[model samples]
Target: MTEPQCPLHEGAPRNHVLEDQCIRKGPRRGMIVASSKIYKDGSAEVKDRLKDGFAFEKRSCMHCVDPGCVSVCPVTAMRRDPKTGIVTHHPDACIGCRNCTFGCPYNVPQYDFNNTWGGIKKCQMCNQPGVERIDKGLITGCAEACPTGATLFGTRTALLEEARRRMKLQPGDVYKYPMGDVSKPDRWHEKAVPVYHKHIWGEKEAGGTNVMHIGAIPAELLGMPPLGERSAASISETVQHSIYSYMALPAVALAGLSIVIQRNRSQQDDNEGGQS
Candidate 1:
């Protein structure tokens, strides 16, 4: 049997098809763009290319431990599931402030410019109300369609263990990489292991993420920002809690507003009496 081609390589129609599927099935018309990095191959036709070959990675919301998008939203539009850890966006509650776009470290949340009435577009892991794939015991479209076992869907604990197992494997050793779901894979894709970069992206990045990445390429090269272990959300949440403790900030603002209104009324009354 012929091995399934990597969907991430340049000019791979599979990636485009997958993206189209995502856009169609998602709440809005936007795709989960997978970042593809082009490198030189050992081909005479494509000169000045590195012999090491090409590297590519899928990009989307990290579904952070303490998501900055969730923290910055004025309305409670962005919410993380306590049980599943899936971060979901509610269009009805969203004020279209575009705070999620600015606050996200991975630059995941996107505002739909084309549609005048469109809300924030993001990956909710097919767990949104209408789609609710997780609730139905179904995997994401990407994970289900990934023939090469490139995009496995499973619990964090199970995936982490698989990642650790892959990290320890020597390059060129044959291993059966699990396909579809990590916990109960439909089948295994047997292939020789490639040299893996020691670091696992999303393990401790911005206090960690539910969606993780493991690849031969360095994460920075795959367009990941250099982030510390501490999440920005945690810091922002702390400051916000301190300032708004006991509704102190809101109460002070209300008092000031009332004083301004009273002063305005007094001035209006004086002006009316002078005219009389």
Candidate 2:
């Protein structure tokens, strides 16, 4: 996908959909994004992985139900939509804290270091205002721009069912896979199916994300974050609440310290009396 502008130096890969396992946000030098943007850094990638051993991976947001970025945000700037399960950020409300950059394990959020005024930019799922394409009954821009039906947009339920259906199909068999929105049959275009991976990414990672993926290659090669079923954000928040609930954290710590100090004083007094 073409970025709003070239975030890197004067000449760099403009916009391309990568399915390899390379990290999107690599080490950078100041405002110049000098990270590895190529499909294959060494012998790992460049093109799509076939069914033999190479797996083609799509790099995108996990959109976890309990994203760490959202949890760590000082403000409620990063929030998940209760109904649609879409994670979006509000620029006006954003304080440019960059807590999200550190919070995310996948590093999906892209910061435009070029301009000091720029806020964090990531795939808001085309939910930007005045471009509510999903609300307007159209698929995401990426899905629409996909000429050969590579990228697709649909409900998590529909996509999961589609993935399950594709898994049952035998290799080398000609099956028409839906290109666009799976919910609306009329919007879909048929294409030859590629062998799908047994596992579906985002199904259970970090308590599961709404945007799921099923690829030919391992999910790791595609740059998806390695996460567990329980979301890190959820666990961290739960632990924090348990420790600090009712503002008892400070009180408990103080009480314990006081007891220790009193015991030490008593022991010193007993030693003096015995010596006397």
Candidate 3:
């Protein structure tokens, strides 16, 4: 069977084993869009200083603290781990409503259109059954296989600390960047730091995300959506709870249905008597 290929994969710089181990062979069949731009300059300083360069922005599920996907999933198909806070999807429980797709601000969850029996597909942090990398105490495939230590895996707390450290560094200063796992890295790659943006992408964005990002350029330039600190999910939940408190909406609907049925029955009896 011909698998659906990512249309955006061709022009962008390919990450090692991201397509092979995490995408095609794994449970996920969704496209992880990576926005990129090519740069060229004719100025003497630009020609002498830098070679052909490209800027890339890779985004997966933000896995929000107050996830809209989990909130909107009526069947509880999309759930967040209480301890780990990882948002996961249960295919068996899925009704194929595609509610989660619309709920997510990052547009992470997607339907597998090419499959015979299509389902929702997104990164579950490789913790799903038969491919439980996180449960097995191993890092994700993308993190494990990244040659340049571009991707690192760890607890949210540790990552935030690391991100803060990076933000404080001078542009040309050499720093020992960890590879693979953040807490217990396989090795350190020392390199001169580049300029960094002051903001952390996911921090306080729609009530924060477990998967945060810190980069050189502004996140908006890299296709990250602008969001408020207050979560959309939390706001919606508050409104829904107030309206449906004490089963008021359901009771009102039931009462309306009963009245309609009673009126219909009365009209039928009158018509029957008139006909006789």
Best-performing candidate as measured by lDDT: 1
Model 2 misplaced stretches (Cα beyond 4 Å): 1-56, 187-194, 245-276
Clash totals, every prediction:
1, 3, 0
Compared with the true structure, model 3 gives a TM-score of 0.73
What's the lDDT for residue 267 in model 2?
Answer: 100
- lDDT digits (tens) for residues 1-276 of candidate 2: 323222221122344222222344443322221122223334554233432233333444567788888998898888888877777777878998989878887776666666669777666677666567666776666565554455667888888888788778886577776666766644444545556668887888888887777766556655555788998898889899987786797888999999999999999999999999
Compared with the true structure, what per-residue lDDT tens digits does model 1 show for residues 1-276? 011122232122342322312211222323333333333334524222224355545665678988999999999999999888989889899999999888998777778666679667776777777678888998876677676787889998888898999999998899998988999998998988878878788888899999898877677755578899999999888888887796987899999999999999999999999999
What TM-scores do the predictions have? 0.74, 0.73, 0.73
lDDT of 3: 0.71
| Reference-based lDDT, each prediction | 0.72, 0.64, 0.71
lDDT of 3 by residue, 90-185 (tens): 999999999999999887887867668878877677677677778888777656766656677899899899899999999889999999899999
Ranking by lDDT: 1, 3, 2
RMSD of 2: 7.6
**How far is 62's C-alpha from truth in model 1 (Å)?**
1.4
